[model samples]
Target: MTATRLASVVLVLLTLCSTAVPDVARAETWEAVISATSPDGLGTATVHYQHLAAGDSPTAEEINDHIDAEANRAVTQAMWDGSTRRPWTFDASGRLTTWAITVSEVFTGVYNTAEPHMPMNRLGSVVCDTRSGIIISWDNLFSDKTAGLTRLGEQLETQVAAVASPTELRTWRRSGQFAPVDVNFKYWIPTREGVALQIPEVQFGRGLKVVIVPWSAISDLIAPEFLPITG
Candidate 1:
């Protein structure tokens, strides 16, 4: 073959080789389960959490570490803490506070996809402590907790107002619920799109209202621990 033709072929091969190779930054994640359980008023309180190891984005491990720590804490507290003092099934008065005590990890997207080195895979957990139940707010997941909460609260007002009916909005305002300035937003879950704020069942006699807040809306306020919550 002519030198010129051979040179062109070699260049094309090099380009193909480079394109086929995956970036080093993207780590392969092998899924692992970490669980802990403790006795509860009913049967038992269990925390079965998922951990992403050897996956993309060096920060995956750091985020999983946070998940593990928080999960373990919830189980431990439910087991030893005053959780049983007021049981969900029945309290000292023999009145049922709740049906059961169950805690589960609600991973974002409702599943764990740690591979491919994506941004922060935010985690939210719900520990059914019975009486009032246990919630791991988005604020608790970060360091600048107050600031994060403030932003989350403020954003929720707009989101909530857009969907609330006139009657519902009035009820919220008159009932001192969803305060505009104080955003006492509590109880959140990770959704496929963003963080979902669960309006307590006690508030409106139902939990049909869920204020879905995107991470971009409060990214600036999040702490370094769980910052850059982008996928």
Candidate 2:
């Protein structure tokens, strides 16, 4: 072949090779489980968390590290801090659009037990974007924060009242947890069925109450990009 034709063919092959390779900057996650004990033999930390399985983007790496660190932090607080709490479950789910992480810890020891009669369980979670790794804020999830929060609050109250006793409902309403505010609804995780809103023991006189607000209920209120949140 002529030198010019040969060079052209070589350039074409190189372009195809590059195009066939996966993008290193694409963010992907892998879940890892570890059962570890503190060095001082005080307690144990068995946590399930996410890691940057495939991605080189700075944002993705940072978010992955943050997620890992947060999970480790929760376990560490229980172990080294003399809390004697055991993580019953540390579960997480991810899709092409979103990632959700949740941890449920049970208090076994007497330390920091305010209400001995009440349940000794705590729930926590973190949700973020899959690509940019930016933590999904309340503002990002809802298009109109005020209206969205009001709707969420209404749904939460309706769901809780359905199962809770009249007295329990009175206590829940007095607690002001279901108010249209971001701080009130902290423990929430995205699920395939809907967004699972958690009402911990502290907020409700009863034990933990999880209410799944179906996507259909607030489909229009949700941001367009976050529509059909898989998990």
Model 1, range 54-90, lDDT digits (tens) per residue? 2343444444454455554443333443233333211
Give the alpha-carbon lDDT of every model: 0.41, 0.55
Models 1 onward score TM values of: 0.43, 0.62
Could you give me the TM-score of model 1 versus the true structure? 0.43
Best by TM-score: 2
lDDT of 2 by residue, 135-193 (tens): 66578889998888888888888987887799988887887878898877776776667
At residue 55, what lDDT does model 2 achieve? 41
Top-lDDT structure, candidate number: 2
TM-score of 2: 0.62
Instruction: Look at candidate 2 and tell me the lDDT of residue 220.
Output: 85
